[model samples]
Target chain A: MKLKDILFVAITAVLFGIVYLGAVYMGAALTGILTPMGLGIYGYEPFYGIWFLAAVFTTYVLQKPGVGIIAEMLAALLEVLMGNFFGPIIFISGFIQGLGSEIGFAVFRYKKYSLQSTMLAATGCTVLSFIWTGIRSQYWTLSPMVVLGIFVIRLASALIICGFGCKLLADGLAKAGVLKGYALGLGQMTLEEE
Target chain B: MEKLNPFLKGVSILVCGLILSFSYSVLLNGGIIAVSLILLLFFSKARLTSLVKILVPAFVAAVSIFFTGMMFTSGSAIAPEAVSKVESLNFEVMSYSMTSVYNAIQLSSRILAFAGLGVLFAMTTDGEEFVKSLMHQCRLKPKYAYGVLAAFHLLPCIREEFAKAQMAFRVRGIPVTPFSMKPVFAMLVNTVHWSEHVAMAMESKGFDGEGARTYYTVTVIRWYDWCFLAVTVSLLVSGTFLLPF
Candidate 1:
């Protein structure tokens, strides 16, 4: 690992952290206002799944194997450092979520950036998140119907925000000429071509 | 300034977080006294900045709780005749609905308490030093740890970009208000794009996520670290005992 790469990852991680924190605060506030009105679940759903955007951004920009993991971990670390309510829980989630998205890239052998891959990444992450929620018993006492509802909402949110959302962001960056060397690289070589 | 070793600080924060969580679940039922004691150390160590950081979340929580409680309990009367004589209403359903809302409010406050403790820790600690300690004491991989450090520094840059994005929107006659989806979406898109650039630059520098790495800064654990760890363990133990469950 060259010093420059280390520095780059570090810088990206910090940016990811700040974004994660801001999103969490906004998500929490949204949840507070919406819960009484029957819209609370969507608030947490979108923010949690949005971590995949960080993963995709890191993977797309870094164009490396572990960037996803490192970015996710950095965001988790920052969230913890900033005093998130869940503390270590954020770390664990980051680790798992990072791995989930990273695995999607790994499956393609880090050679593809198709919309299908993005969708797979989203699905992978949502599955991992669901497992974590089950282990933490976040859904333990809820009836089967409620548990199913949470799962469906979480999956839909991830697909929309992380899957399609990441694609949109990447395409915009490509258009702006910021991603010339990476997989989302400009001109005809971009993921949009696939 | 006397600095608490980074490892010790990290450990202490984690422990405090756990204790706070436990206290909220078990001891919170005992009322303000229990909550105050649970948070006493945090309060003593808090600075003005930390207090201000928590104020918004606290205020929101308080209002939510009050409204939820009012909605639920307004119909309940101590006297049996008071309910029917007052007016026939959907008292049972209202009460049931309020119970869930009240529980949510209580949960929100507990969340605020957790967030407050976190803000206190973040305000008191230094990011660079903390990463150094993680590397030295915890033996965290240098590449990963430094990556985190870099991310911390870039936060300001991202914030600046976020502001610029908002300003540009405002210039275009778009309203950039809180809870507005347009500005938030625009910012989100821009952030993802910037991060991609950051990643590519890192890749160009040969950051393949493997191989040995080195660092210039050193972090060491001292006697104070051990003391902090001991205090954390003791607090956890006592908290467990005091737990209502």
Candidate 2:
């Protein structure tokens, strides 16, 4: 990776760290309000994608190998530093989730930034997340209906938040000319033709 | 709290946390939490009020995890017929569900383990120290390491930058608010500019792209780190054998 790549990843991580901190509070409040209304804990499913979006957004902008995981991991590190409740375990989750996002772009040879590829990456993230929650949190105990509900909600959230939402955000930033030297800003045919 | 090497503390928490995450034994989780609590009492100088602030969410998390985990038991392998078999569990209150109680243990314990470890690490570990240790011990490239640390150190400055941007937005007579997109757009532009400048300045100041670098503050793992690790591992092993759960 180039120096700019490293700097972008770090800068993105720092900025998103604040967002993630606020997200934790907003997520808790949403769960509190919704859980008692028959929504149960799955009410918080929509917010899940925010945790995994940094990787996808960074990768979308940088369009470089390993930037996805590095950006995601650093965001988690900032969370750890800011005294997140998950502590160092955030690092482990970051590595897994980021890789899940990276697999999306990597499958397209890191050459495609289409909506479908972003959605595919997020779909993989939901699957990976489900697997992790299944083994560790004992998701097998939930009613299959609830399990399906969690799956569908998380998947949709990932597509909307990580896929389209992030794409739009990065595009906005690129349009502002902040991302000029980067892959996304140089017009699609500039550096992206590779 | 700050006395411990950040890297050692981080590694210990991750290892102990993994063990906590995987084990099904509630007693073991409780034991680990108790041990961690005592360590905090002895070592951490955190104020009691701040400690409560950290712990309230954890307690809430444990309760929610337990209750939520219970609801999931409906489709588990425990059979729908077994839901009515609260007779074996005995002692029933009004509208009590055995499935929820039974399934709640693993998740509740998991939450306790995570919360305990999280609190201890947060109170004890320093972010800069951890990054410094990574450079010193892991031989991380100075460029990336410093780049990350520099970004971290800029957290306070970022607020000032945001304030400046807000003022600029007002001067431009453009509509802006905290909830508006203007701040985010301005920040994205600002940080990108700063990062490019910093990278260029570092390059001009004789910074190599990627190579070995020297560290002024070497994080030495003290004897206490080993002792802490040994005790945690031992408690983990002993709990596995001793707890019937």
For each candidate, report its DockQ versus the true two-chain complex: 0.23, 0.59
All predictions: root-mean-square deviation over Cα? Answer: 7.2, 3.2
Task: Tell me model 1's lDDT, rounded to 2 decimals.
Answer: 0.61
The TM-scores of all predictions, comma-separated, are 0.68, 0.89
Model no. 2, DockQ: 0.59
Which residues of candidate 2, in runs, are more than 4 Å off? A37-40, A187-194, B75-96, B164-178
Error of 2 at B92 (Å): 11
Residue B207 error, candidate 2, Å: 2.5
Best by TM-score: 2
Per-model CA lDDT versus the true structure: 0.61, 0.76
Q: Which lDDT tens digits does candidate 2 get at residues A123-192?
A: 8777887788767677776667877888899998888888887888888888777777788888654655
Q: What is the iRMSD of the candidate numbered 1? A: 6.8
Can you give the lDDT of residue A119 in candidate 1? 79
TM-score of chain A of each: 0.80, 0.90
